[model samples]
Target: MKKILLIALIGYGGWQFYQKQSVAQPVTEPTVQVLPDYTVPLQKAREAASLLQFRCDGRQHCSQMKSYDEAVFFLRNCPDTKMDGDNDGIPCERQFNKG
Candidate 1:
């Protein structure tokens, strides 16, 4: 009788442990990616500004304009400006200086 009771108690404990472990674990959901509010063309324009060596000039004028538009504006309005540090005709190439 004692042996049978011990076996039954051990079996019940094992079943409780298994049930607890199964209930504790949860299923996770997948994450989603989000896009920015700016248009693709506007983002391209910003890249052009960096190439053109268009700086903030402490006035924040170019901050509002997209990169490409800023480059075009600088090139057209300030042709004599020495943006092309290497004098390579390409205003804002790698050799150009921001300061």
Candidate 2:
């Protein structure tokens, strides 16, 4: 009887020790980084600012224009401007076109 009681006590103590050892510990999470968005190009902003220098004028033909940018602005905004000879979107292809 004493032997049986001793074996049972040893088994209970071992089970308690195992239960304490098997308990889980708390875990930590990793950090994350966020980035900003750039929707518009820098060149387009500069183009918009440069476009403010010109307005719709009655002047026609590429000869009256000082620069390629001025000729384009005249073609787009003003009427009766004989700049684009080929009827293409580009104005002053012979005068302003580099390529």
Candidate 3:
């Protein structure tokens, strides 16, 4: 009976040691994904030109525009913009004139 108990304790201690060794493995950080160098600038330019730039939000007058480019964007993309009076595809002519 004593020998059986001793064998059981030894088995339990071996199992605990094995579990500790398995749990003590060194952790490694996950690998990071990198974009190509050429695509990085293109992606940044696209974000700067589109996502962080102008959006159509119900503004319809040339007086509400800050620049000619903004008025053109609104006139071309947004609905019901009154910037182009003659339908010549040019917007905000008085606000931003050609010299």
Candidate 4:
């Protein structure tokens, strides 16, 4: 009887292990992008071009950004941009992904 119980327990454990392994899991990873610094557009002929810079000091400009691209632009070029709350290279989580 003891031998039969042990065999049953081992079989049950193996079945549980197989069930765990058979379960499919979804893998998700946020795509990281390398963006370039942009310049403010000039409105005149031979106009002097200036680098796009903003002081993300007050009110946190990340939330005000229209899109993730703008957040990437400010975060890349501006020295004061603070869109990346976790400093994970990606920025504007709340605005971009509703994080």
Best candidate, lDDT: 2
User: For model 2, how big is the CA root-mean-square deviation?
Assistant: 13.4
Per-model lDDT: 0.57, 0.84, 0.83, 0.69
**Backbone clashes in model 3, listed as residue pairs:** none
For 6-91, candidate 4 gives per-residue lDDT tens digits of 99999999999999999999999999998999766555322222233333333347757876766765676667766787888888
The list of candidate 1 runs beyond 4 A from truth reads: 27-99
Q: Taking the candidates one at a time, how many backbone clashes does each contain?
A: 3, 0, 0, 0
The digit string of per-residue lDDT tens for model 3 on 31-65 reads: 99997776568757865686347999999998899
- By lDDT rank, best first, the candidates go 2, 3, 4, 1
Q: Over the full model, what C-alpha lDDT does candidate 3 score relative to the true structure?
A: 0.83
Say which candidate scores most in TM-score.
2
Residue-by-residue lDDT tens digits, candidate 1, 2-58: 999999999999999999888856778988989678656887877675656665343
Clashing pairs in 2: none
Clashing pairs in 1: 45-68, 46-67, 49-67
Q: What tens digits encode model 2's per-residue C-alpha lDDT throughout 1-99? A: 999999999999999999999999778787786778867789898778668998876889888888888888888888889988787778887787633
Q: What is the lDDT of residue 24 in candidate 3?
A: 65
